[model samples]
Target: MSPYSPVAEPPPRVAARLRRPRRPRRGSALVRRAASPVALLVLWQLASATGVLSPDKLAPPAQILRAMVEEWHKGTLQAATGVSLQRVVIGFALGAVVAVVLAVVAGLSRIGDDTVDPPMQMLRTVPHLGLLPLLVLWLGIDEAPKIALIALGVTFPLYVNTVAGIRGVDRKLVETAGVLGLSWWGRLRHVVAPGALPSFLVGLRLSLGVAWLSLIVAEQINATSGIGYLVTDAASFGRTDVVVGGLIVYSLLGLATDAAVRLIERKALAWRLA
Candidate 1:
């Protein structure tokens, strides 16, 4: 056979097909998502206008919106929002730090597990809200009790989730780290922390929800300025619109924080998308 007869030519290369441009469905998607809430607002307005629902007992959405605007212009909304945000931020930070420290210690050592876990588990059994009177007596009617209540509410969910995540780290990965002569900190940084992140973020979201709930209750007691105080003052004046406005503010804040955390989780846990 001739040497030239032996070779077969490879198939010719093909260019990649162009991708179709994506249609912008954002407006439609947003409208769909907002449909229910908008319909509810319309229903509320209709009910109030037709006298089917008393505006005194339950404010119409229009009245509530007007009250919200009025409060905003008076700076009462701003002030109350600031105070409430401050309490939540401080309490959430303290609770998170303590929970992480405790969880890490317990997860890393048997002695720490034995020493810290039992007492925390015991404390978790107590209804934190029931401590309102004790908290008032101990910490007074100041920001201390309010923030402390938020802290207490923020702690348990975080602690439980963190401990579970840490303990749930794969034994094989830990052993492999040791086999590779990685230090404890190195192993934790590379292996444990990443594995535990999803659980930790879930806990963060739950803790945020609980923190807001605790803030509402705590602020109701001797609150000088907060959404809770605003609601209380409005209630005394029989201003249902203001009360509804304050509650809507609380609900929106909770939803916003939850969304923020979910965004963080999506970014941090993008590997799971694979």
Candidate 2:
């Protein structure tokens, strides 16, 4: 080779520049998400304030805000919220437990699937809303009926999703666990429960929405307190602002609960990020 024969320069070093991550814009996400709702509120306020829309039909954002503040000051809103929260918590717990038990039985055993599935599928089809009259008649117009109503609404989605998730666990993994002599509970803990988590979370979110809806309906029937009572009371008294304000509270509660589920997902599913 000639002395000046082309010397191969070393391939350029693949330097990955460790640039600093962008600083999170504090409240940026909230502000961006608020855009559309804010615009709609602006339009609503303008129309109601300027008489472009009849206040008799609907209240403006300002009026709704004032009424909400008034209720808050009077402690009615707080009391109602507490009552409603209690009902939801109790109902959700009851429903979630029943759903998990039923799902486990149905998903894990052929006998259980045969016995539990048909009735559940049939029950899910009947609109639980229509059972309001029967519930009131049987259980009386009290907290028991309301709680039971909410429980019924919250159950089906969770049950369906959990069963699907459990059934979807990899048969191979399950067999391997069995071959390794894992006990029933051990196999479930290792191979089944983790696989079912995501679907269960999705069901949780869905069931929460249903729970609120059922509460709204249940409270409409002789409700003495709760956000639903607030709406019904306002409608009777012709206070459109208060009615709208109560609806806003419902929306906020739903949003907050969904956010909570999302937070749980982030923590529980951190393994996926790996």
Candidate 3:
């Protein structure tokens, strides 16, 4: 070829076809997502004003907002929320620890898997609330039973998911690690765990939801304290506003916990996200 040869450029249409539009900004995306909720709020206000629903049976959204504000000012809401959060935190931590240990053991050894997996699978089928009576009888009506109930409800999801994740790790990757002279611990740490992380995070999210539900059920049982107690107590006394407020609080708390866990997952699995 000649050293000074000239090259032809592609047509403008061909060049243009290769490009993609930039995505909308994050702030714009958030505003677009928020429109539905804002519209619903306005619709609710209109319904309340028009008497479309009985205000006595279902307090207006405005009244619920006012009750929430009043409870916040009185500090009762904060105290109750704090107590419920503490119970969830403690119970979730205990359940996650035990589940991870069991999952790791079951994933590694055939005997351990055979021994633990059958009972775990069987227990997973039982509704968590069905165990409340037995738990209460065995552990009593104190915090122990409540915590145990939450732990039991939360454990199986994590255990099953984690075990499945470990087992689903790619055999090719494991073999590659072996060929690279990795030890068993090194192979697990670098290959298996990272591969399993997405499933593990899914399990964590499921377990957190179960923990919240179990806490609500546990708190409903003769609880002298907690947000659940506050809701049930308010319901019994015909304070529907307070009951609705308690529900609102629980919804917010659950949203907050889920958001936190999602953030953790995103951070921990940045590679996977990419």
Candidate 4:
């Protein structure tokens, strides 16, 4: 070999071929996701303008927007939203905390599982709406019953998912932790919880949705307040525009809650993403 000769470099074309495509920025991805909703708005406007759909029955999207603004100005929207959100947060937090504790215990201990699992499974099968009358009778047509109903609605999803998550912890990981002289608590902290996080997040999201739905049903009973009350009142009076506006508010609230949970999940489980 000639001492002065340099090693051959890969061709620029070959180097370029090995590079991956640049991903779109996060903001761009969000904008792309938003496009469909904007398109739907435009289509709604066109349909309403051409009288293709009966505005009296369905109420044009523009009219619904106007109603929403009017309701906001009247302070009814804000009050209703506040009451609904308060109930959801209070009930969901309590339910989720209790469920997590119970689930973790049941998942870890055969005695705990046998004692709690069967009853929980049966309770999960009971339709929430069917329990409303009984709940109202027992707890009264007040915040108590409403909050209880929401708690019950939110609990099962979290409990079931949590149990599944704990049970799904990898056997090999557990064995490795055992070989490393890790205690049961250490194994759980290092291996089990992290393994279960994705499923737990999913359960959190699902439970949030159920919380809102249950609150709506709960609030419909003798409620002179809340978004559910507004919707039911508007519906009774055949005020389709107001009803639609209330529904839009509920949807926005649910979306906001889910988004918040997803953000927390992403932060907490950053390692899982890798």
Can you write out model 2's per-residue Cα lDDT over 1-274, one digit (the tens) per residue?
1111122211112121344555787678878889999999899999988899887799888888899999999999999989998998999899989999999999999999999989999998888878889999999998989999989988888898899989998899999999999999999999899988877877887788888878878988899989889889999988999998897787777777867876887788777644
Candidate 3, 201-239: lDDT as tens digits: 778877888888889889999798899888988888777
lDDT of 1 by residue, 109-206 (tens): 89999998999999988888888889999999999998998899888878878888899999899999999999989999989999888778768877
Task: Write model 4 residue lDDT over 1-274, tens digit each, in one string.
Answer: 1111122223234455688865766668778889999999889878878999676667778889999999999999999999999999999988999889989989888999999899999999988768999998899888998998889888988899899988898989999999999998899999898888777876887888888888878887899899989988988877888988998888888878877876887688777555
Candidate 4 Cα deviation (angstroms), residue 138: 0.9
Q: Give lDDT: candidate 2, residue 132.
A: 89
The predicted structure with the larger lDDT, 1 or 4, is 1
Clash-forming residue pairs, model 4: none
Candidate 3 yields a Cα-based lDDT of 0.83
Off by over 4 Å in 2: 1-34
Instruction: Give the candidate order by descending TM-score.
Output: 1, 2, 3, 4
Per-model CA lDDT versus the true structure: 0.84, 0.84, 0.83, 0.83
lDDT of 1 at 256: 82
- Give Cα distance to truth, residue 258, candidate 3, Å: 1.4
Model 1: pairs clashing at backbone N, Cα or C within 3 Å: none
